[model samples]
Each structure stands twice: as C-alpha cells, then as structure tokens.
Target chain A: MTTETKPGVREVQADDIAAKVAELCQTATHVLPEDVVAGLKRAEQTEKSPLGKQVLIEILENVDIAKREMIPLCQDTGTTVVMVDIGQDVHIVGGDLHEAINRGVSKGYTEGYLRASMVAHPFSSRVNTKDNTPAVVHTEIVPGDEFRITVVPKGGGCENMSRLQIMLPSRGKEGITEVVLRTIEESGGNPCPPLVVGVGVGGSSEYCMLLAKKAITRPVGQQSDDPETAEFERELLTKVNALGVGPQAVGGSNTAIAVNIETYPTHITSLPVAVNLQCHSARSKSATL
Target chain B: MPIVKKDGETRATPPFTDEDIAQLRAGDHVRFYGTIYTARDAAHRRMVQALQERKPLPMDIRGQIIYYVGPTPARPGRVIGSAGPTTSMRLDPFTPALLEQGLKVIIGKGGRGSVVKKALQDNKAVYLLAIGGAGALLSGTIKSMDVIAYEDLGTESIKKLEVEGFPAIVACDMYGGDLLLAGKEAYRDQPALGDYVSVPPAEKAG
Candidate 1:
C-alpha cells in the first residue's frame, strides 16, 4: 500500500536492517546501553550502603567485561522481543514479514552467543521451543516512511513475577497502587532486585500486558511525557522503594530504580492493569531504520 | 544422623563449626568449608521416594548443604562450568522433609517458601543466596566435583562437590533474618513509604 512520507524520509533497506539488527542484538547483550549504564551509575553514587554500591559497580564491570570480551551479558540470554515501528510507507521487498523477523532473531542470538530460551507450550508439557522462535513482534504503523526496531531481552527471573489484573472501572489509581504494591511485596527477592517496575494502565487485558512489557523496554529514568502519567511514575517509584526490597533484596535502599507508566484511551467499561518487572540486568535497546 | 557414603565416592566430608558460620555474614566470599551435595527437582524426587520406603539415602544429609543446581556439562578438563544457584522455590516442597533428616544448609538463588523458612529456623540451619547469574565467577570457587548417584539423571543427578570457602550470601539465617528481606529493605531508594522491605547490612562487599 502506497502511503505519504515527510520530505526527508526514505525507504528502509533490507540489508541495512539485517546488519543493523545483528549489531543491535550483539550490542543488547554485550553492553548495558547508555541509559541503563547511566542509571546504574546514578544508583551507585546515590546508593546508601557500601555493599549496594559495590553491587552496582560489579554490575557495571560485568557490562564492561561482556562488551570487551564479546560474551553474553547473563547466561539466561533471554527470549528475543522485537518491537517494530513501520513508517507509513517503508516496505520489505525480499521476503515475508514474519520470516524476516524470525531470521533476524535466529541470526542475532546464534551469532551473538546468547542462549536460546523459548518454549512451545503454556500449561502442559512446557517443551523448549528450541530456537527462541516466533519473536514477540509488536509492529506499529506510524507517521513517516522510516522504520525503527527495538529489541528487548526479557530474562526469566523478572518475567516470572509479572502480573495482569482486571480491575473494576471504579478502582482507578488506588487500585493500581494496591496491585503494584502487593505484587512487589509478594515478589520479595524472587525477581532479583534492585528492580525496574513497568506498569500498564487503561487497556484491555492483553494490551495492558503488552503495555506493561513495553513500558519496561523504555529507557530507565525517562518518564512518560504526558504530565499525568509521568506524575504517576514518580509516585509509584517512591512507594516501591519505600518497601525496601533493596539491592538484590538482601536489602539496603534501592528496591526499584524507576517505575514507567503508560496508559491508553480505553473502553469506558475497562480498568485493566499489568505489572512487568525487569531484573537488575535490564537489557534492552533500539535502532531506527 | 549417621554419615552415609556412596560406593563410588572419593572425597571426605568436612563439617563447619558454629565459629565458622559466625565468622561469616551476608555477602561474604568464603569457599564453602564442607563438601556440598548436588540435587535439584529430579534428584529430590528420588530422595523423597527413598524416604517413603525407609531406604537408606544414597548420600548422607548430616551437616550437608544441598545446592539446587543443574550445571551445564563441564567443558573439557574444567571442574565445573558456570555453577550458579537456581530458584529455590521449586524445591520448597521437599525441603522440610530433607531438613528432618539433618540437612543443615540450603544454598540457591531466590527466596524460599514459608514452610522452608520455618524448617530452617526449626533445624537451626541456614539458607544462602549466591549471586544468581555470576555462574562463571562462582564455578571458580569449587575445588572439584564428582558424581555420586543416579548418573542417569544427567545434569540433575546427585553429586558430591568438593569446595573450598565458596562465596555465598546468607539469605535466611538460623534466627531468621532473611537476607532477601533485609537486602530489599536496605537498597530500595525511592520506595513507596509504606513498603516494609529493609536491607540488613549497610556496608558493601570488600
């Protein structure tokens, strides 16, 4: 389908994308990404105890070692999550969209030395999907002809503690707070602290879950630009750290690094919420095509 | 509890005195003083079944800390590869029963259930949470590892691991200050005030 583009916008190339995706995959595991490293540095400086600061330093050093030595950041390696934003006019000429994404993930993980962590089932056998296939692809058709892709590696630890709730429409912010607090409180140290909590508000059940997951993919310390939503992030961040699930939850003071909140115009009848926790490794990054 | 040794064993068991444990605190890098035994979901099943039949355990539990790990097969001449802790929550069901047989220490990553916590307290034992993903760093602490039973369990089999002062963090101690709880409390910078998690130690690891 032909679509409009801005004056400077150009079509995204397949080879460029393949090379870029490979680099993004390798970079995702090897480096902490600028934002996350900065976040850790800030946490280190402001960290209260000598131990928590040391943990943060070790985390920083680990990131450095992976980058320098070209090793997978964590052994878990994580399942590949690809977020694609297709501009109004860009197209993939050589192959099917699904195949292209899968091909990229396969090459990236295999060549990058990352582990394969996908499974084929939900409740029953829970067999390993083997190749970490069928990447969790989120595509958006947006304003210009330039495409962008953000790949996130979601480790099993924090992902296990994720939760979604269908709240009474009347429940609102108070309900959101309760769900968030109870989830972290119950999680204790299982998710592996210090944690970054991502909250999804005002969508149907599934999308709310998606929002929660996407919220985590956002860079640390950046708040939702919407004033109301950003305020919610601040309020949530304060409350979570107050619970004291400090660094590694062995305890000191940095329970949660930040809380990112995203909301959508939802059905008047729905007040769904989802909480997706990201462990300290917090590996994610993006590239525009 | 009587000491039990398997037919193929080639190592001696080393017990730690109360002074040994007292000298250590949360987040200390001590090579584990005693020989640690390996068991995870699969091996625990056999242990439980052996108990039900009133059969002698293939390995003794006295003063032993059973580590919940299924290490990646050692590469070439390596003693162990990336040996880090897995979530202990999965083994929570089998913990108390094992504790009754004198399992004094449980080493793994992540927290355990209330049942396991109470059992540790009741037995005057402890639970240690090692750095979860520092598998390469942790494997370096082990002096040696040898398989003892259920060789067919693959990576999940029972094995006796000979270790020196292994780096470990006391997650839940005998009197019950769960480092998990204290760790959470100490580092939570901007927590919502009502949240009760607190860190136990104010100093960083040396």
Candidate 2:
C-alpha cells in the first residue's frame, strides 16, 4: 500500500519502520555509544579522587559487560524517546505512524527483555504499562527523500534531574551558567556523573526543554554549528568540571564530559533555559531508512 | 554478624547487628556475601502503608538490607538482567519508618536528605552506595532472585536475592559520617563567585 504515486517519491512501509525501531531499541540499550565510551575513558584518566576514578572504572566495566552479555547497561532502560525526521517526498504506508512506533517500542522492550518502566497514570494509581509502550515521539518534516529515526532510552534518574526556567531577559549568559551549575551541583550523584549536560536556550519553555534533549542526542564533544554557541558550550564545560562533582559525584575534576548547547531566537522579554542531563550510560542509536 | 575489615575493605553478610554497623565508616568499601531484599518507590510506599495500617509486612525486613533496584526481566537461564541501584533519595520519605522497623542497611545510589541521615544515625543503620548505571556488572553479583511479594507491581515487586561479593561504598554510616558530602567538600575548589568565595590566606597577603 503506497500513499503517493508521484515522481521523486519514496514509499516506506510502516512495518519496516517498526522493525528498525525494535532493533534500535535493543542495540541502544545493550551498547554504550562510542562517543560516550570515549568520554568515560578520558574521564577515568583525568579523575583525581581514588573513589571517583574507581567508579569510572566500574562504569566502563559495566559498559563492557552489557555489550558482551547482550544486556542493558542500566536497569531503568527508561521511557523510549523516538525522534523521526520524515522527508516530504517520503510516504508512510500500511499503518498509523505513531502506533507503529509504539508497537516497535513494546515489541523491542518485551522481546528483548528490557525493563517496562513507563507507568499508565503518573499521578494516580501509577500502574506499570508492562511493555514500555507509548514512546514519546518527535517528528519533523525535512526537505529530502530520506526517513531517519533516532531512539534514545532515557533513564528516570537523570531525567528527573532535568530543569527548565524562564528568566527575565536581563539574566543573560551568566544567569544561564548559574542555573546549569546549580542544577549540576544539586544533582550531585543522582544523575550518575560524569555527565553530558545539554543546554537549550532562547526558545519557549517547552521548546527549550526539547532542544536540550536534542542537544544530548548529539555525539559527545560535538560542538554546535554556531561559533558563539560553540564557545558557550566550551565555557559551560569548563565551569561544570570546575564544580568537582567528578565521576559518580564521588568528587574530582571530571564532573561533566561535555556541555552541548542548542539555541534559537526568542521573545525580547524572555530568556528561557533548559538543562537536560544524560547519565554515564548515555545510550542512543539512529538508523536511516 | 560483625563486619570483618581486611586490607582496608570491610566484608559482611546480612542480618547486621548494631555492632556490625558501628564498625562501618563512611567511604569504607564493602563486599557482601549473603541475602538482600530488593524494593524501590512503589514497594516502599506499600510497606510504609502497611505499617501505618498496623498490618504485617509481607516479608521479615528486620536486620535486613534493602537494595533500591528494579531489574529488567532475565533472559532464559540467566539469574537476572542488568540489575543496578536506582536513586535512593526518592525513597527518603519512607526510609525512617523502615529504619524504625529494624531495617539495618540501605543500598542504592546517591545521597539522602538530612532527615534520613538523622534517622540513620538514630537507628544505627547505614546507607551504602552502589555504583549507579553499572547494572550489568551488578547483575553478575546476584546468584539468584525470587519474587517474595507485590508481584503485581512487576519489577517493583519485592524480591529476595542471594548475592556474592556484592560491592558497595558506605555513603552514610551509623555514626553520621556522610561520604557524599565529605567527598565533595574535600575536592571542591575555592568558589569563583565573589560572594561565595572566601579570601584565601595567600591571596589576602596580596
């Protein structure tokens, strides 16, 4: 079943998308991304405190065990977050797109034996969804004929530490730095440092949060495209490490491995900043189909 | 049983006596070889509720260690999947009551609040820090696991686990020594912010 018969159009089966998402879910959970692994290795070398260094070593060992044993690096396995970029020239056929994604999430989580962490009613009974369904999917329409999907299984601990604040325009970069530092300081060991701090600036409160989430999905240590933003990322990274939260917050110089900042134009009277932290596991994977 | 210290590391099995806990100090690395019970937020809430309602708890938690973990489903032939500690501070609200019921050891990641710390000292219990996110490695330490109660909560179910050489650090000891705070204080650099920074003795001479 094809949606479009026009020239220059590519028809992608929704079932195929589900299969890819399912595969990605398992792989992302079992394997730590190379960039994050490298960041941890670097942290292990630079960490000062004995306990902090030992924690980094154990984390690296855990990464190895998960990869070798084909198991999740962390038990939380987390709420599956799917980011999809659909080309205008590409048509999804055979099923509803959102349902297809959720199907993939459920199948991957259940079949792969990952934890079912999502709860049905957050503020009520809080029953477990049982299959880790209803993934948070963000979709974008791009200019090409390619459909790309990125799966991020975000854990509860670090996600709980994320924060967003809408400040007066008068509070500029210094204010943003203060918020980020304070968040990191307050978080301490809970988020499982050394962390990858994602900073989103300039959008609305919600969009800023999304941007911060997107920033963390980028490869660790990859600077922003904007020159000024890249500089800001460096500055924030220096300040964050200076906090001496170190690996697992046992205390040393390696508090955060990277600070990725994403910014957009915002209203004149508002300065919205969101800080989303990714723990040491930092699991994420992508596929283009 | 009392804790045995050898080569600067403490080793112990469960059913910890007050003497065993008193032997532990903040920052002491411990390796356990015995039984532990697993429970997190949901199970803790129910247990606390049971206590409040004057109903008996499903399991005998006295002199027991509670590991705050909800592991993934184990694959065929495996004892458990990646099983690691969740954040402990989330269970801070329900902790004191558990301590009151003779809960001796709490194992998880991160620090606890002041009230929980005070409770730990008052009850002569200890808080141990398991390496967070090291689930796969931690799972290797579990020799076996069984659902003891609250099976309906799925992974949040209370499970009794037999473990061997399970490693952890004493984050908060019975004497009120707190490793998380002590670690940060020892390594934290002088504040860069003028308002928070103290004038160093060397800098004052300038």
Candidate 3:
C-alpha cells in the first residue's frame, strides 16, 4: 500500500506497536502503578483490625517482591483487555491492527512465562488456549495524531464480583449507594481488599459497564473532575469501608482504598449503574506511540 | 506437634491429626511446612467425578491439605512462579465430599459457604486463608513442586508442593468459628443496611 501524502499525518509501523504492547504486558503484570502502592500504604495505616493491618503489610511486601524478582503480581495474571485510542490522522502500516495486538499478547504471555488463563470454549469444553490469545481489544478514533494503548489484565475473582443494573430513575443517589455497598458486602473477601471500586452511572446498560471498567484504569486516588461526582465517590467510599469487609475480608476500617465514579447522560426512564471491583493488585499500563 | 505461639501464629506440618486441627482457632496465623497438594476449579471437578464413578483417586487425599492455586509457568532454574491462592468458594461443592474422605485442611483465599463450613465441623477439618494477590511473596515459601496428575490441564493440573513457613490465617475452624464473619462484625462501624436493594429486571427492547 502507498503511504498517504497528507501533511501532519503520522505513519506508524504495526510491528513497533506490537513490540511496545508486548513490553507493556510484561511490565504491567510485574510492577504495580505507584498510586496503588501508595493506596495500600494508606490502607495499612488506617486499618483498625490488627489482622487487617498485617494483611496489608503482607500485601505491600508482596508488591515489592513481585517487582524485585520480576514475577507476576498475582497468579491469575488475568485476561488481557487492550483499550486503544487511535488518532484519525495516523496510518497503521504492514498489518491489521487487531492481529498485531493479539500477536503482542501471545508473545508477552508465552515469552514472559505468564499464566494462560484464557479458555477457548466458555460453556462446553472449557479448554485452555495455552498462549492466552485474542485479547479483548476496544478501539476508538480520536482527534490527535497520537495512538495510545492501555492494557488491563483483569483477574476473574474480582471481575466476577462486578455488577450492573438498570434502575428506576427515582432511586437516585441513595439507590446507587445501596447497590455499590451491596456489591462490596456480598463480594466480601473474594475480590481481595483493600479494593479500588469503579462505579458507572447514568448510561445504557452496556455503556455503563464500559464506563465502570474505564474508571478503574484511572489512577487510584484521582477523583472525578466534576465536583459533584467527586463528592459522590467520597461518600460511596465511606459507606463501603463502613461495611467492615476489611482487608481480605478479615474485617477492618479500610475495606476500600478508593471509589471512582463516571457518569453519562441517559434515558429519563432508566438509571443504569455498574460497579467494577478491582483487587489490591490493580495492574494496568499505558503507552503512546 | 502444634507449634502455637503467644502471638497467635502457629507453625505446623501437614498430615495433621484432629488434635493439631483442634488447637487452631479462627483468626490465628499459621506457618505451614512439608507437603501439600495444589488444585483449583478444573481439578476439583475431575476429582469429584472420579468419586462419583467409584474410581480410585489419583492420590490418597486422606489427612491431606489442598491449596487452591493455578500458578504461572516457572522460568529456567526456578521451582515455581507466583504461587498464590485462588478463591475457595468455587470449590465449595466439591469440598464437603473431599472432607468426608479424610481431607484435613483446605488452603485458599476468601470464605467458604455454609455447606463447606458444616462439612469442616462434622469432619474436624479446617480452612485457611492465604494472602490473595500476594503471589510472589508466597512463591518464596514453596521450595519445590511436581505435577502428579492431569498434566494436560496445564496450570490447573494437580501438583505436589513442598513448602516452608507458608503463611495463612485460620478462616474456618472445626469448632464453627469463622474469622470472616467475626472479624467483619468486630470492625463494622455501623450496622449492616439489612437486605440489599432490589432492582427491577430490565425490559426487553422491541
């Protein structure tokens, strides 16, 4: 294919994208982001139960060991979720975008010695896809000439605990709080605490779920830019901690480190909400090409 | 001998007797030594199926401990990699049956269901909680590993593991004490919100 001659257009090689993605997958699984580490430290200080404090200490130690030894932070290394924001002015040369991403995922998991958690058949055979291929990739076209890819390796334990609901608009903030609290309580110790909860409000069902997932990709302590949303996040975080599901659900005052909320305008009759609970590992990495 | 310390941390080896299990209480810390078996969702399902068909199990599980984990592939010159616990509740259905067969201890992350708790109480077994997501640190405790059965299952295969100073907490004991419930009760700043709020089912779009 001939290269486009448009001015200010960036031509990026598909192979370079694959290489960067491969490096990111390995690095992200090995080292947690700094913000999450800080959150865990804060949890250790704030935890009321002695046992909970010990658990947080161990968790922090584990994080350090994982980074030092270059091993995965968690055994569930998880399903690779790749989110790409491609600039409309950039041209991807040499291969299909998705194929390159999957190639990168396969290379990263196999060469890095990460677990192959993906199974080929969900219902019947449930066979393991040994290489952990065909990552769940989401792509969006944006205004700039920059291409950004964020890889989130979501573990099944916490991902399974996530929930979404279409609520009556009348339920409002109280209803949303109740749903978030119920998810955390019912989840108990399964999702691993201290959790970073992501809440999505006021969109269609599927869109809200996406929003919740995106909310988690944001840094742990950063709040919503909107003041009202930030207040809601703080309020939800308080009630969730009050549930006393504590670190590892052994009960403590620091059940969750942060609550992040994202909202979108929706139909008058529906108030769709989704809660995505992230374990203490909370691993994600992004790179721009 | 059960090595119960004043600090609530106990050190014990597997092939534990009822006396050893009896000495443990919910919320106490434990450091395990010697051999343990690794199993998770797939391995448990197959073991339960074997019991149903009246076939001999791949190994003698009597008086043994099962750790719910699926570790990453070990790199060159390593015995294991990131060996942390998976959630235990998924094995709840298969656990009671194993406990009935003389399985003495279960090691994993998270809480067990009522049926499993009753089984532990009746069978004098116990459940231990390992640190979830703390895989690398836990890997340091494991000295060696060998796959004994169902190698084709990849990471889900049944393996024999030799560990030293493997840390965990007593989550459920034979005396009906559950740390998950008790700990949460102690730390809760306010009463629970009673029943969960019910949301109406979504309407099908035309």
Single-chain TM-score of chain A, each candidate: 0.90, 0.98, 0.98
lDDT of 3 by residue, B109-156 (tens): 998999999999999999999999999999999999999999988899
lDDT, model 1, position A179: 100
Best by DockQ: 3
Q: Write the per-residue lDDT of candidate 3 for residues A25-84, one digit (tens) a residue.
A: 899899998878877887787777889999999999999999999879999999999999
In model 2, residue pairs whose N, Cα or C atoms come closer than 3 Å (at least 3 residues apart or on different chains), thus clashing, are: none
lDDT comparing candidate 3 with the true structure:
0.88
After the best TM-score superposition of candidate 2, give how far the Cα of residue A31 lies from its true spot, in angstroms: 0.4
Off by over 4 Å in 2: A1-4, B190-206
TM-score of chain A of 1: 0.90
Please, what are the lDDT tens digits per residue for candidate 2 over residues A175-222? 999999999999999998888898999888899999999989877756
lDDT of 1 by residue, B1-206 (tens): 12222352212234643333444344543335558898988789899999999998988887677888766445456686546666688888888999888777778777888888788778767787766655545566677898999887666778888776565666776666676666665555544332222223221110
TM-score of each: 0.79, 0.95, 0.96
Instruction: Score residue A189 of candidate 1 by CA lDDT.
Output: 66
RMSD (Å) per prediction: 7.5, 6.7, 5.8
- Cα error, candidate 2, residue A251 (Å): 1.4
